[model samples]
Structure formats: C-alpha cells, structure tokens
Target: DCKKAVSGKSFYAMEGKPVCPKCVGVDEEEEEEEEA
Candidate 1:
C-alpha cells in the first residue's frame, strides 16, 4: 500500500512506498520507449 504525505502546499502526494530495483528498471525502459 502507498502512504500519503501532507505538504505545506496543500497537496497530498503518495509516499513511503518501497520499490524494487527490477521494477525501476522496467519503468525506465518504458519511459525510453515512449521518448523514442
């Protein structure tokens, strides 16, 4: 599950979720494909 962080700007963003390195690598690949 994701946690929410309250910032001074009045916007709550998702936080405190740990991501695996493999997932990050896959996300990078997807972004590269989109840029291409």
Candidate 2:
C-alpha cells in the first residue's frame, strides 16, 4: 500500500490491492490544478 497506515477514511480495490483515495485519483487532480 502507498499509505503507511489506513486511517479508516475510505479506499478502493485496485487489482485486489487496497489503494487510498488520494492515490486513486484525488491527489492527481489537485496537482493538475496547481500546475495549470
């Protein structure tokens, strides 16, 4: 997992692996807005 700990926020299953919300999509969109 990309996160050190699961904070019980939420997650999505990626090929049977748990991935955090940010890792899935949130962070990338934010980063893109900042770049723009």
Query: Whose lDDT is greatest here?
Result: 2
Q: State the lDDT at 5 in candidate 2.
A: 42
Candidate 2 residues 1-36, lDDT tens each? 575345765667777887777676654233435542
lDDT of 2 at 18: 76
Q: How high is the lDDT of residue 16 in model 2?
A: 87
Task: State TM-scores per candidate.
Answer: 0.24, 0.48
What is candidate 1's lDDT per residue for 1-36, written digit by digit as tens? 423343332332225455443333333223445543
Name the runs in model 1 displaced over 4 angstroms.
1-15, 26-36
lDDT of 2: 0.61
Worst window of 10 by summed lDDT in candidate 2? 27-36
In Å, residue 21's CA in model 2 sits off its true spot by 0.7
